[model samples]
Target: MKKITDEQLNQYLEIRIKLGEENFKFINACYDEVLLLKKEEATKNIKFEITDFSKFRDFAKK
Candidate 1:
């Protein structure tokens, strides 16, 4: 199995977010399916990080 890089994943995410509503839903569903495959195949380790956009906005006001 080929390793997936952070850049590749981010590019995919950006593309998905820019898609139309119906396409976005489809992309999300496919993402879930691919994640399962990645887990099973153990291609590479993946991690998720979340940030609060509101916090960034507050900081910008400073």
Candidate 2:
């Protein structure tokens, strides 16, 4: 995901301000999409540990 330019940010803010509250739904939708993308990107390099469940079998039985 590329970063948005300052010009683009200004344009979006201007349009959002002029459009008022009615445009909130659209803004929120865009925000959700961006947030999802960022979260996906952040997790791309994560290393997950696999837990061994055999050790817990006796506890579960008890």
Candidate 3:
């Protein structure tokens, strides 16, 4: 399995369309999976700390 960029996927889709290929659904599914994985990978390193919920509660009451 080769890693492909979003641009590459779009280009390939264009070529497939031009050639009248029938695998558009499959390719779009792969593209969607790639985007999801990319989003997950990007957020994997994020860290959150909730040290003050009281402030949020006060704000919500207003």
Best by TM-score: 3
Candidate 2 clashes between residue pairs 3 or more apart in a chain or in different chains: none
lDDT of 1 by residue, 3-31 (tens): 99999999978887788678988877998
lDDT of each: 0.81, 0.84, 0.83
Against the true structure, candidate 2 reaches a TM-score of 0.42
Cα displacement (Å) at residue 44, model 2: 1.2
Provide the clashing-pair count of each candidate structure: 0, 0, 0
- lDDT, candidate 3, 1-62, per-residue tens: 79999999999878788756567667778889999999999989976469667777899899
User: How far off is residue 12 in model 1, in Å?
Assistant: 7.3
Give stretches of model 2 more than 4 Å off: 1-17, 47-62
- RMSD per model, one decimal: 11.9, 11.2, 9.5
The pairs that clash in candidate 3 are none
Cα error, candidate 2, residue 36 (Å): 0.8
The predicted structure with the larger TM-score, 1 or 3, is: 3
TM-score for each predicted model, relative to the true structure = 0.38, 0.42, 0.44
In model 1, what are the clashing residue pairs, if there are any?
none
Q: Residue by residue across 1-62, what tens digits does model 2's lDDT show? A: 79999999999888888889778778889999999999999999976555646646767888
